[model samples]
Target: MTKPHRHASHPKLVARLKRAEGHLRSVVEMIEAERPCLEVATQLQAVESAIRNAKQALIHDHLDHCLDADSSEHDRAELKAITRFL
Candidate 1:
C-alpha cells in the first residue's frame, strides 16, 4: 500500500474548518433566535467563505506536494476534477 502524504498546512486547514464549524453553529443559533434575514445571510456567507478557502488550500497543498514529475495522467485528471469546487 502507498504511504499517506501529510502537508505542512494541514493543521491550519483543520483550524480553519473548525472555525467554520463554529460559524455554522452560530448561524443555526441565529435562525432559532429569529434574527434578521440579512444578518443571518451575512454570517452564513462568512461560513461558506471559510469552508471554501480551507478546501481550496487543501487541494492546492495536494497538488503541490502529492503530484510530481512521475504523477500519472489520471492523477492530473483528478487534480482538475478537484478544482471544480473552487
Candidate 2:
C-alpha cells in the first residue's frame, strides 16, 4: 500500500491536539479535586471546544490538500466519513 499523504498543516494540527490533551488532563484533575461544578464544566467545555476545533481543522486541511484529480473512490468515501464528525 502507498504511504499516507502528509499535509503541510499536520504539525499545527498535532500541536493543537496536544494542547487539547493537556486541557483534558486538567479537566480530569479538576474533577478529582472536587472543584465546583461550574468551574469543572467550564474547563470541560474548553477541552471539548479545543478537540472539536482541532478535528475540524484537520478535516478542512485534508479536504483542501489531500484530494486531487487522481483521487480514487475510496478517498471520496473517506471524505464523506470524516465530515460526520462535524
Candidate 3:
C-alpha cells in the first residue's frame, strides 16, 4: 500500500522556521555575551513562544486547508490521530 500524505511542508512554515532560527541564534549570542540572567531568560522564553506560535500557525493551515478539504471517514481518523499528537 502507498503511504498516506499528511500536511506537506510549505513556504510559509519554512519562512517561520527561518525566523525562529534567527531567534535561536540570538539566544546563543546572549549566552556567549554574558548578558544578565534575566535578559537571557527572557530571550529564551521568547524562543519558546515563537516556536509555539509557529506550530499553531502550521496546524491552523493544515486544519483549514487540508483536513477541511478532505472529509472521508479515513481522513477523519487520520485527523483524530494527528490532533492527538499535536
Q: On lDDT, who's better, 2 or 3?
A: 2
Q: Which stretches of candidate 3 lie over 4 Å from their true place?
A: 1-9
Q: Which residue segments of model 2 deviate by more than 4 Å?
A: none
Query: 23-69 in candidate 2: lDDT tens per residue?
Result: 89988999999999999999999988988888888888877887787
Model 3 is weakest, by summed lDDT over 10 consecutive residues, at: 1-10
Provide C-alpha RMSD values for all models, in order: 2.0, 1.8, 3.5
- lDDT for 81 (candidate 2): 85
How many residue pairs collide in each prediction?
0, 0, 0
- TM-scores, all candidates, are 0.87, 0.87, 0.72
lDDT tens digits, residues 1-86, model 3? 02554455567778878888899999899899999999989988988887887787776666776665547788677677667635
lDDT of 2 at 82: 79
Model 2 per-residue lDDT at 56: 89
**What is the lDDT for 80 in model 1?**
76
Candidate number with the higher lDDT (1 or 2): 1
